[model samples]
Target: MKAAAETMPTLRAKHVTPHAFRHATAVHLISAGVDVTVIRSWLGHVSLDTTNHYARANLETKRKALEKVTAPTTPGGQPSWKRNASVLAWLDTL
Candidate 1:
């Protein structure tokens, strides 16, 4: 084991720790669009807020997502669901 460690000295380089691996895994899951709740369960976190902190994205990613949202409208300036009143009323009953 000593010889192997010597061959890969950087593997035990300064400031590299197990927690870094865990943090990287969490960030990878978040980048892949995995749900926060699932990441919390995977990391055995008792509080969802802790998981949220781990998955906090940068401002640029948030801005890009917001830019992709298109408004709901039809070609003739009408609402997208003009004939969906009955469907909406049925959903409200639930």
Candidate 2:
């Protein structure tokens, strides 16, 4: 990082930390479909729960997962869940 900063004065290394790099790497790997257990092992995390936190941080992944289970549209051209307040409320609990 320092070497790049020296050659490219525009490179800002001051704001970057090892933790930031680790977080970025975790997010990237999660987005790329790597298994959480592998990431946990690579990061030396003792628990899968800790690595899951990184997985949860990827909004794109969350969105993709949501898209997979999305309710199908009804004959009215809207998902039935959209008309059910209780269903919406239940979904919010997730």
Identify the candidate with maximal TM-score: 2
Q: How accurate is candidate 1 locally (lDDT)?
A: 0.80
Candidate 1 local lDDT, 1-94, one digit each (tens): 3564688887555465678889989987887789999999999999999999877786655886889999876776766465578877887899
Clashes of 1: 0
Tell me each candidate's TM-score.
0.54, 0.56
Count of clashing pairs, candidate 2: 0
lDDT string for model 2 (1-94, tens) is: 7787988877764677899899999999999899999999999999999999888745787788888896755787877888889999999999
Per-candidate Cα lDDT values, in order, are 0.80, 0.87
Q: Alpha-carbon error at 35 in model 2, in Å?
A: 0.9
Query: With candidate 1 superimposed using the best TM-score fit, by how many Å does residue 19's alpha carbon deviate from the native?
Result: 0.6
With candidate 1 superimposed using the best TM-score fit, by how many Å does residue 75's alpha carbon deviate from the native?
A: 8.7
* Cα-based lDDT at residue 87, candidate 1: 77
